[model samples]
Target: MELLYEEAGQPCFGLPSALATAYGGDLGFTTPCLYANFVTSIDGVVALGPEYPSSGSAISGREPADRFVMGLLRACADAVLIGAGTLRATPGHLWTPDHVCPQAAPDFAELRKKLGRAAQPQLVVVTASGDVPTEHPAVQSGATMATTANGARHLEGRLPAACTVFVAGERPVLRMTDVLAALHAHGHTTVLTEGGPHLIGSLISESLLDELFLTTSPVLAGRTDTARPGLIEGFELLPNRQAWTDLISARRRGSYLFLRYRLRSSCGLGLGLSAACRKRCPT
Candidate 1:
């Protein structure tokens, strides 16, 4: 992994020696904000749909550098947030810093301890339907599940003893602002969302996402009727509403290109900025 460029005025966590050496630079984040990480193929495919499992790994070809970056980001967060779809796709995976890149596990632990975080960042799953794979290993281990009232009723008594459920809203679609508020109220201030596109799209539509770390894998995932998706889905932002970005950093390892971008403020707030979402948007 090598740093090609990085912007100044970025927050610094002063990563432990081992992590810093492998990451090619220091990494940190502004507190009380949400950031998302994703790997897209050169042809702009983030997922190969439900038929393909662990689509992100397939997209990146499980590049070691990408995994290290994923682990590093997870290490810096107070919680790792994801949609139920993301959880369902990777049944064997754990949303932990070491799960993706275990080589720097001890260093990650040191960083977490120094920062006063939990042994592992809390795993948060957001699902409006609450129809996630309940028998998955990660769910059985434990996770904070946020869902709608209806979804809660559906999962009543079905979820394992380790999982705790929170009814965040009464929705056909969750506003995401409310979900962030619930997480904020719980003290998981710095969040990292390894998203399934629709979840991140909800955040972007709400103008709640602060930054994006994207790894452009040098591969092409051609779309078929299988329902491939890009970096954002569930909504579109174009001429009417746009969330443009500022490139804050860029890195490279082999054919993979790691880029960090900060989303610019939007003019059309949609159902988020206006319609009461603006006030609820987390800082």
Candidate 2:
């Protein structure tokens, strides 16, 4: 499918061939997944205000441009996993291009068909404390919750019978590495992580991110402390270990900047350097 974005007042479309090249990695890479890293303006703001209707207003929900980029991101993901805090704060339709089976009981037949299987491209929630309310819309949509074994049991009574909860670890906080590994084990390789800053920071700190898609908005939220929080606090990457995110695509749709980046592999460091030197040396 053709993915479109807006850049510098012009429409830019992402070519499938380009996407493949941009995302290419080691053929033996066991769990190739995609992680999303986005930042709002300087203010620590993702939404406008309490209403959380995108930009905190009804007249315009999220800037149309942002919505489009997000939709494209969702379209490309095999599964969308988010933290429980994110789900509780911004619960809405999980993904797009997928039909919403509002009714149709016994099984989410329509939703399942849209997802393409009994368990393909699942919507997953990651939680440490298992604090999610069972009545949440995300849970109601049959989204599976991934937590530790203790947390899962603690939440068993509240969770719906249809929901499948997976234990990611034995600890209290859900380890993202374990979650990703489990998802990979289940054949859900192309995972997407949409975050709430803290969660994003945690992933980055843990070196679990594979790629980043950021949509920069034109309007700046003035509250630097409350509205615009940096992606991470005290975030530092060691030399040579700095994340190598290459800008693969850029688009401008209206007042937003859509950018995509592919994370360079850290595994080939010494080997790549040695090979380069060998190529340059005299026979």
Candidate 3:
């Protein structure tokens, strides 16, 4: 891995020596920050439609650098969050550092130890309909499910003993703010979410996300009749709206481009919330 450029004043967690070397540079996040990680095709397609499962791996072709970066991000987070849809899409996946890049497992463990973090970052799954794959290995291994009251009722007695369930909101909607507040209250301030596009929409709709780590795979995923979602789904943020971001850093490994961006200060206000955005983004 090679770091092409990085902005000043970035947070530094003082990662383990081995991990830092492999990652091309140090990485860290501000306290209480909510960041996202995703790999997308050259054409900005993050998902190859719901019919094609494990779209991320396919997009990146399971590149070693991409996997290492994924593991590094997971290792740095206090908890790994995802929506039920993401879990369903990747049946056997585990949201852990070692699971993606076992070659760097020892370094990841060392990093966690130095930071006084848990053996593994806690896994958090969000759902509104309560329709989760309880048998998925990631869920079966252990996870914290945040869902609606109706969802909780539906999941009652179905989740494994290792899993913990929480009712985050009422039926029909589960606010990302409430979910994040709960996680923060539980001492998980440095959170990393790898949810699918739908979940990304929810977080961005509320202007909760702060940073994005994007990997541009050197392949084009042309869209056809099927629904192929980009990095942000469920809404449009162009022309009438804007999602301008500032480039924070850039790195590269082979043909893949690892880029980091800081979301604009608009707070992601939709047309309905434009008035509120004024107070959030005075400029």
lDDT of 3: 0.85
lDDT tens digits, residues 15-109, model 3?
Answer: 88888888887887766678899999999899887788888999999999999999999998999999888988887899999999999999999
How high is the CA lDDT of each candidate model?
0.85, 0.55, 0.85
Q: What is the C-alpha lDDT profile of model 1 across 188-261, one tens digit per residue?
A: 88999999899988888788888899999999989767889998998888988867898989999988999999
TM-score against native, each model? 0.92, 0.68, 0.92
Select the stronger candidate by TM-score from 2 and 3. Answer: 3
lDDT of 2 by residue, 1-283 (tens): 2234222221122223333232221011113555674646534455544345324222123564455345434544567887776677665645432322222122223323443434335678888778886787667768778888777877887877778888986777777778877887776776677775667766766677766777666665665344434555436666745766666556555555666765575233311122222212121
Clashes of 2: 12
Clashing pairs in 3: none
